[model samples]
Target: MEIRVLGIGCARCNELEKRVKDALAELGIAANVEHVTDLKEIAALGVLMTPGLVIDGKVASQGKVPSKDELKKLLGGGK
Candidate 1:
């Protein structure tokens, strides 16, 4: 699975990436996680806010960080 964290390298953006990594580690699911810092790319993804979470190329969450539990529910168990 591919997960993209869109942000301009702010603290919240970094924290979101950490949370995503933690979630992946907890779930034991291997995914390609990328941090998007380019304004053009972020805008192309239709994210007007930082800390946007994109799973499998589709926008999952925007404007805020999601909890690890919430991430598990969103990503599911065992891939």
Candidate 2:
């Protein structure tokens, strides 16, 4: 799986990335996680807000940092 965190290096963005890792670890899932900081690229992804979360090329969330549990649910098909 591929997970991308889109942000411009803000604290929230960093936190989101960390939570993504934590979620992956908790779920015992391995994924290629990337942090995207380019404005143009983020815009291209249809994210007008920072701290966007993308899972497998699909936009999952944006504009805020979700909690670890929320992230896990999102990663786990909302279960």
Global local distance difference test of model 2: 0.92
Local distance difference test, per candidate?
Answer: 0.88, 0.92
Q: Write the per-residue lDDT of candidate 1 for residues 1-79, one digit (tens) a residue.
A: 9899999988999998999999889888899999999899899999998889998888888999888899887777324
lDDT of 2 by residue, 15-69 (tens): 9999999999999988889999989989999999989999988899999999999
Tell me how many residue pairs clash in candidate 2: 0
- TM-score for each of the candidates: 0.93, 0.94
lDDT at 53, model 2: 98
Residue 11 accuracy (lDDT) in model 2: 96
Most TM-score-accurate candidate? 2
